[model samples]
Target: MSHSPAPRRRIPAPRPADGFMLLLEAARDLRTVGAVAPSGKALARALTEPVRAQAGQPLDILEAGAGTGAVTRTLIPQLAPGSRLDVAEANPRFAHRLSELVRAHPHLAGRPPEQVRVHDVHVERLETGRRYDVIVSGLPFTNFSPHHVEAIMDRYLELLRPGGTLTYFAYRGTGRARALLASPAQAHRHRAVERLLAAYRDRCATGRRTAWANLPPATVWQLRRPAYAVEHSGTRAATAEGAGGAGGVPGPAGVPRTGL
Candidate 1:
């Protein structure tokens, strides 16, 4: 007998209670929460654009710092059959919430049980040998020190397979806002992070988009790994210098949750 393929799943509206819990978490620990509110639908869509572009092909995906699963909800439905998604969150509370989200998400109901997975540790500690085709990040780079940011970024590029994409967002006006209220030392840290990011942007950036419908407007950037990912000239030596190969993105000694 011949039969039609199952219809694609539609996204469900977020629940009020979920939003409330997210707000509470953010209030309790703004440093790890990233935003006071869950990622708006528009922003979620923007961040998941890379996955949509790879429709019909199986892929390995990673979503780091998924504070409340707003972005997770959008990402799961877009994954092609046989695709794998690993969500890494450092905060135990947020991680628990994400685990629940994965179990209850309608779109993931009939897929392979392992299609979606969550880790309660930092992204830097995720234990995986598979190279990812895409990585969607929700971490707040501005919250951590420059060295931490660099390590995280380096780990991300390393985990990606050749020509893979990495997407992430930063709240709009953060630079100006920080300059006005941050201490001189704090401001310096932000500058150092920016300079580090600028170097990568110059080398690997593909495109960027502004999502205005979010609480605090944000910009999403997409960067592609060089075609020769394993042998990129500049990064080859660095990746060899005792860098945590595949299972982890080693943190600087004494640094906790380096960038996730």
Candidate 2:
């Protein structure tokens, strides 16, 4: 009689340290890091739903504020052949880790080196000439000032191609919490940001979903750029102010204007 050997269980790559890193970064700057823990699996899934919806087609994706690459891990596996991903992380440490992850991702091993690129720069400052088909944002809009939020949102629209989708998440109860526990100035700022975002939502939002499984429940909002090119004077005013009069919605020269 012959004895059969047991099958070995595969061990996942080490990721236990991401939580600690997130905490450290949050402590250093809560405005940028926002949450103390990395995003949960459910949240990542909700934020990447647009990409999954466009499965089987090559897509260009941009992931902003990719702290610890939690969502990046989710985005990479779903990339179709010939697709490209550009990850932007403002934090140097997080950007370094993201670069390493992009390099080591198994799914990208056989793909061209340019298939994935990690940029250590703020998403607003990122100046890639190419537009994206999907933009997944992990930035904490609630933590930022109204001006910054408007600037970032404008930049996202500028980076997206017409008919492109943008997905982002906001933690639940944050507005209420700020109203109760934050200073008057903070609360006012939050309210201003809310109003600004509400305008964008009214103009472009397609759908929204809640991810209850996340550490702090979050609502993911999906906005689609209009398929046709049209101009909006209100958007032009907001974009000009957000860009500090540096001309409207700066991008690669000759990029067609897709007014929000």
TM-score of each: 0.82, 0.86
Evaluate residue 89 in candidate 2 and report its C-alpha lDDT on the 0 to 100 scale: 92
RMSD of every candidate to native, in Å, equals 7.6, 5.8
The clash count of every prediction, one per candidate, is 0, 0
Question: Candidate 1, which segments miss by more than 4 Å at Cα?
Answer: 1-13, 229-260
Q: What TM value does model 2 have?
A: 0.86
lDDT of each: 0.77, 0.83
Stretches of candidate 2 off by over 4 Å are: 1-14, 234-260
Q: For model 2, where is the 10-residue window of minimal lDDT? A: 243-252
What clash pairs does model 1 have? none
lDDT per residue as tens, model 2, 118-163: 9999998998899999999999998887667768887888889989
Ten residues in a row with the worst lDDT in model 1? 236-245
